[model samples]
Each structure stands twice: as structure tokens, then as C-alpha cells.
Target: MQPDLTVSRTYSGPICLQDPIDKELMTESSLFNPLTDIKVKVQSSFMVSLGVTERSEYHGKAHSGTFPHDSNRTFNPIHAKNKAAYLQNLSSLTKRSDMRTTGVFGHLGGRLGIPNTGVSLLIPHGAFSEEASWEIYLAINQSEPSLQLEGSEILLGPEVTCGPPEVTVSTPFALTIPHCAEVNPDHWTIHLKKKKEQGKWEEVMSVEEETTSCYCLLDPYACHILLDSFGTYALVGEPLSDCSVKELKVAVFGCMSCNSLDYSLRVYCVDNTPWAFQEVILDEKHQGGRLLEEPKLLHFKGSTFSLQISVLDIPPFLWRIKPFTACQEVPFSRVWRSNQQPLHCAFSLERYTPSTTQLSCKICVRQVKGHEQILHIQTSILENERDTITFFAHDDSHFPAQMGPQAFKIPYSIRQRICATFDTPSAKGKDWQMLAQKNSINRNLTYFATQRSPSAVILDLWEARHQHDGDLDSLACALEEIGRTQAHISALAETQTEESHFSYSRQNGL
Candidate 1:
């Protein structure tokens, strides 16, 4: 029956936990329950899902291979499911040793790289009705002196899992914000000393947000292909130049454990190809381009990452000015957590763009012993002064599309500041894209390149490459380096010309 009298409820207040306890519950004995000691008790039928990390070393284990999931996908399901499972489990546990597997009695484990933050564990407890009452407490790690930082912002545990039977976590799982981790990467330790000093930070993980795409770009090459040691790459397409067509290629790489990743490439008709965040792969025919004369290779390793690709445009000896090759790799995997499921295993060739140049293209060819390679001989009557790039064609009807100079836009610049240094070509055969998203200081990458470099300016490029790609910081560094390199090269050329003139007079006994 409807209520005889109308009642008003406060709708202005946000759900919040008051006086959340901020200290770890000290167990009187080994047999004490952490929940009861902390004044939060749970019923026996109810289950609790605790957040745990099943370190490859912490607990005994075995089993390693390419993750069963697709290599081009990424997601953290353990933290996701645990949050869901916890809502149903609804009670806390005490046996840290027996909590690694699923089930209400087990602890939900996940891998958050290192320096994980935001304590968004699945708080498993439920309220049956308005009469059901209980309390939740969150206390800082009072035991760890280093964890207590002055002016640090941290959540002292919420009063309860304020979310409904389900909660949308801020990020499916917690991120190992550097400086907050107990273990550190060799690279992170040396370069991230400053960010770590910020002190301990904490967060509860019950929020779900999208993560940035890990867009892996690859460029194929023959004589100039840089990364040879870490073998992971693939080459495809015909050898010809069609100003309007943009053919495609792929590279595949594998990582340790059960993780593989793949990337989509957007091939262009010209020798130049800009790496971008793509969700699909492109095939040879659609783009008016073809493969090069050389074959590409793939390098594979069982885990941790590192590999590269090259895009080559080999114009014939002196006749047709076209590309010989332009293909990228498609990785088979990436880092995966213990409890997450992989994404699907399929990708596709999304689209194509024709050239907008002013020249009328021609289709000519040269036949060898048995195979025939198509070519476009420059017509003597037309005046062509632009710097053109590589040309290719995967097949006949596929790459007949022709493109021209104006079709290729002068891609603008970008910059980013990140955690590691960028690799220099001279350092380890790695090249830096005067325009790539990397730092110039790092020498460990497989392959990277840009126009050219001198010592001091190269250092600046290293910093630029090391900066996160596409961000303002890296772009700024790259721009400065480019200007410096051009200026230095120009000065050196002028100096040589003047010196040559003076030397000639001296030789004549002036």
C-alpha cells in the first residue's frame, strides 16, 4: 500500500564514508581475523575478494608461452572480475597464503607492472537489507616509514564499497605509478630518480576508464634496416611507383610469457610513412604501390620487448624514380597480467588515399629471367624537380593507382617528455626520426633515424626522442634539434669551401 503521509529524503548529499579508520588492524595472534580486529565483521556464507599480486617468484609456479589471446589486444580482466566477484563474495579473509586462485576463499591476484597505485581492490561484502549493518576502514601503512610522506594525498579506505552490486573502476586496475613501487625497472631506476621522490600515494580501485592505445609502428628496409639483433618484422608489396596508391605491409613480434601484440600500418604511395594510432591493417593491392626487390625478416623473443622495421624506396639505377619496398610489422603480443583474458585475434586493411600531384603517371616495366618488375620511366619532355621517394606494387590491378608530390603533406611536428632516453643511430645502429616520437639520448633502441646530427645537437635529439612521442615536450626538443643540425651542417659546408679556396692559393705560392 502507498504511504498515507508523504516523506522527504535528502538528495543533496554525496555517498561518503565518515571517519574511515586509517591504521592496519593489528592481529593479537596468528589466528586472529583482520576484519574482526578492525571492527568490521563478515558472515560465514558471504565471500570476500582481496587484492593480491601473484609474483612469478612469491608463489611457486610454471607455464610460459604466447598468451592464448590475440597479440594486438590489451585489457586487465582480473581486477575487473575480482571487483565483480567481491560484490558477491561480500566478506574478508585472513589467509594470505591460500588466496592466489579464484573462488570466494582465494585472493584475486593481478600484475600492475611496478610502483602500483590506487588501492581499488574488490571489497567483497553485501548488505541484505536496510537492517543489515557493518563498517569499513582504511588505514595507511603505518609500519613502513617510507610510505608516510608529508603532504601526500591518499584515500584512507572508504566507509563501504559505495558502489552498487557493481562499480565502474577509475581504471579497470591500478597503475604502478613510479616511486610507489617496491621493485623497479633497470631503466626506471636510473632515469626516474626525481619522480620517485614525490613520496607514497594510495587509491582505491573501483573505477573503469579507457587506456591509451599502444600503437606500435614499424618500417621495413634492406641495406638500411637498423634493428637486426632483435628479429621481429615482415615485408610485403610489389616494386613500382603509382602516385595515387598507398599499398600496405606488416611485422610480427612476440614477447615473454603468454603475451603477443600486433599493430596496423597505413602504407603511403611515397617513400614516407608516418606512424599513427591505427586499429586496422592494410593490404598490398588497395594502395597504388608494390613491394621492393629485397626480402624482410622477423625477430622473435620470449617476453620483455624490443624490435623494429624499415620502409625502403629504391629507385631503379637511373631510369624510373620509384620505391622498391614499404612494409611494417604486426606484433603478436604484449605484456599480460596473470588473470586477464586476451583480445580477439583478427585485424583488417581499413582504407586508401590517392595522390594529388600534377604529373601524369606512366606504367612501364623491365622483365628478368622469368619474373617481371613494373616501372615508370620519367618522360624527358616533362620537367620534374621535386625530391621523390620509393615506389612499389604488390600486383597488377591492385596498385595501378598513381600519386604525385603534392599528395604527400609535410607532416607537422609533435613532442613528448617521458621516462627513458631515445636511441641514436651512431650509438647502436639505431636511427632517430627527426620527427619520431622518441628521445635522442638513449642508445639502446633497435633502430631509429632522422635527417642528421652532430654530437651536442644529437644529445638534444636524444632528449627529444626520450620524451614521450607526440607530446609537446618531445616535439619541442625535436624541433630545436632539427634547427641546430641544419645550422651546424650549413656552417661546416661553408667552412670547407673557404678552406679549399685558401689552400688553392697557398699551393700556387701566394
Candidate 2:
């Protein structure tokens, strides 16, 4: 005969276990003791009970209203509870508007992305059990409290969070993050760090090095990572050699000084980060200066070479440069450590006559043993009603914010055909596994197996791996090798041709 136990939250009475067969009642103290041999079965309408077998021994200190830890104590619920609380608090700090959420089903995985941030998460099919589902979220840390960087360490991308940290997934998911570093394996060291318990950040892995648990594939503008767990993740880069490079945005702003005949030009070189550029724009606005021309990207190397800024091709008969040196040289350390303030050189030029309304010259910015950029300056010296030099505001829409399926160079129709053709298991070895092998995504076969359509997941990885500069001909060739029909191969080629023509037409404004 089995014991009958009733548990109720509304009942404030003491917890008791009673056996109908033995007609004996046990108190909470003896019922929870390690030495107790009694097994009580709880029946409740409002709650489900987990059964514990008879002779089970409790090994650790008992706490009120909590389960006892096992002898080995591999996990502590208290610590887990604390960590959960900590994560929840941090999550609350992020505004609800900044977070993007999507429904992820166990049988069918989905993706979550934050627009304009170049951050996305791909949840594979069967990451959870058939009955499991979750509302996953993706957010970028763009609020007042920003991530802290150590000495000589730079943040290459936005700090992103993909969580409900307590939710567990059976397989690894792909996370794509944008980075600004000019990646060179020999010159730079990059680390992926995750926020751990008590607000401590721990290095998850090095981008150039492979780890057993995680894999990182670096692209020109982004990084695709395979991770089993989820939390806050960020990319940090440290320069390892003088050849290491960081991108900088160079812009020239000009305005007429207090004297109408005198013009001042301010050349600014700042980190390519969005915030840094925005700050420069805001300051330029206050100084009543207008953008002389569109900004250009400079690949500033970490070499010890100093940067020189000079103006050339100036008409000596029409204008004369001020009393400073014709070329200004900036120290390597001063430009390399520029973050809070942008490095700039100011040049004042006096016109021989107020009637000289046009000024044309070449501004040369160069670094020894590095790259050089020449900006062609052609603008009206005096403020004319028909001045061709118009102020142009910065436009960020030209840059891609979202990268996932859209990043694939292959046409959508062709990709669908490939997925359908290779997804099924074939005895002839013309299946998704073979496709994965060809694409170099076969290392984690077990991870792909859990996905509903392994072929699609593999294609997604391929898209992320080559998002910046993917070659479509390679994929078409691979399809042919997998026994795809000539018709299918021809369709890919035709699509590529049509797209190329369309791109050419758009560029030529036809």
C-alpha cells in the first residue's frame, strides 16, 4: 500500500506525511531526515510532485524551503539563484525598446536580430525538446553605462546579449557580431569575452585559436561564432604588432574666419566607431563649420611611423598659407591613443583678392611605410549664393545593420533548391553531410543533426562565413559536384548574370 500526502500552498499549517496502510503520521523533521526510510507520495490538484525513492540520503546542509545539495555538490541552487537574480537585474537596465524578441519552437528554430547593430542570433531546429518553446531576445548595450576596456584594449563591436540566461539549449547556436578591426592573424589578438557571475567578464575564446567547445570564423566586417551557452558577449582586440591596423574616419571641415578673406580648414582623424564620428559632427556643428567633402576611411596601422598632413597644388599666385609649417607631423603615440578627442591639423589660407571666389588644392595625408589618401578640395572661397560646395550631412543608412539570410550572395530561389535537394539522407553520399564537408562546416556533425533542416543551417553558416565577400561561383560549382541537374546549375548562373546586370545598371543610373 502507498502513502497518501496532500500539499497545499494556501494551507499555512505544518507539512506532514501520512501513511494510510500503516496508519502513521510523520512530521516534516523526520520526513526530510536522511535516515528516514518512509516514502510519501503527494497528491495535489494544483501542483505536480517529483517522486523521491525510499532510502535516498540527503548529503548537504538543509536549508528552509530548498532542496539539499548532493554529496559531490556539482551545482549550488543558491549560487544559481543569485546568478539568475543578477542577470535579471542587468536585463532590466536595458530599455524594452532596444530589445528584439522572437518565438523559438523546439521543432522549428528561428532567428532574432537587432536592426542597425549588425548583431543576430540563429537558433537551430531541435535545440529544445518537442514540447519546449521560448521567447528569446537580442539586445545591444547602447545605454549610458557602457562596457569598460582595459589598457591598450579596444572594443571592436557592440556588446550584445542573447538570453533568458537560464534557458538551456541542447545544441550550439550561431551568433553573428560585427567588428571594426582590420583582422590580421599575425598582427592582432582578439578575444571573445562573456559576462559571468557577479559582473565579472571571462574570456570565452580567442578568435584566431580554435577551442573544443566554441568556434569563431572571422570575416572582413563581422564574426560568426558557434556557442552552446548564452549570455552577454563582446569582441575585444589587442594590438600584437606594429602592423596591426584600426580603421579611422578622416573628414575636413572648413569655415570663413572672422575675416571674410581668410579661410580655416580643420582636418580630423578619429576612430571609425559610430560614437566617435558622431561626437566630431556635434562639435563641428557648434563651431559653425561645414563638411568640405565626404569622409573617407583610413586604415591606420599601429606602426611607429608618424602621420604627415600637407596641402599641395595650391595656386601660389592666388593664395598664401599662414605662418605655420607647410606640413604638420603628428606623433605615432598621439594618433594611436586618440579616442576621447580626435587628432586634427588646422590650416589657414589668405586669398590675394576678395574677388577670388574659387579655391582648389589637394590635401595629402600619409603615413611612412603605410597607406596614403589624397583629398581633392574644390570649393568657393567666398560664401556665394550659387556656391557648389554644399554641406552634406552624414548618412548611416548606406551601411548594413542587419546581416543573416540577406547576406547570402546566392539567390533565394537557388538556395531553396539547394536546401531541398541536399536535405534528405541519400545512400549515394549526395546528402547534406557531403554538402557540409564541401563547405567546411562538417566538424560539428552532431550539432547540425539536431536542426530540422541541417542543409539550411549549413547554408546559413556559409552565408555568415562569407557575408562580406562571398563568391557565388564557388557555391554553384559545389552544387554541380553534388549531382544537381544542369538545369539547376544554369539557373544559378543566370541569376548571377541578371543580378550583375542589375547592379551595373543601378550603379550607372540607367
**Tens-digit lDDT string for candidate 1 (1-510):** 111112212212121121111011111122112121111111110011010001101111221211222343333333554755643433332112111122110111111110111111211111111122112211112111232222312111111111122223211111111111111122111111111214433321111111121111111211011110111111111112111111121222111111112112222111111110011112233332222122111112222232222322322332222133232232422211100111112222111212212222222111112111222322211124333333321111221111111111111010111111222232211124333432322332222222122222333233212212222333333433443454466568789999999999999998
Top model by TM-score, which number? 2
Task: Residues 1-510, candidate 2: write the lDDT tens digits.
Answer: 121223322222222333321121112112222222223222321011111222212232322211111243233222455666745755664554534443333334545665444567776544655554555666766554245678777777667787667778776678888776888888889999998857778888887664566768777767898877878898888898877997877888888889987888888887665545655666788888777767777888887798888988888889889867568999987777675566899999888888887888888888877888888888875545334443223232343232222333443333554565567664445568888877756455755676667787677677555544534534543543443332345567789999999999999999
Cα lDDT computed for each candidate against the true fold = 0.21, 0.62
- In model 1, the runs with Cα more than 4 Å from the true position are 1-441, 447-474
Best by lDDT: 2
- Count clashes in each candidate, considering only residues at least 3 apart in sequence or on different chains: 108, 0
TM-score of each: 0.19, 0.57
Which residue pairs collide, candidate 2? none
lDDT of model 1 at residue 368?
Answer: 16
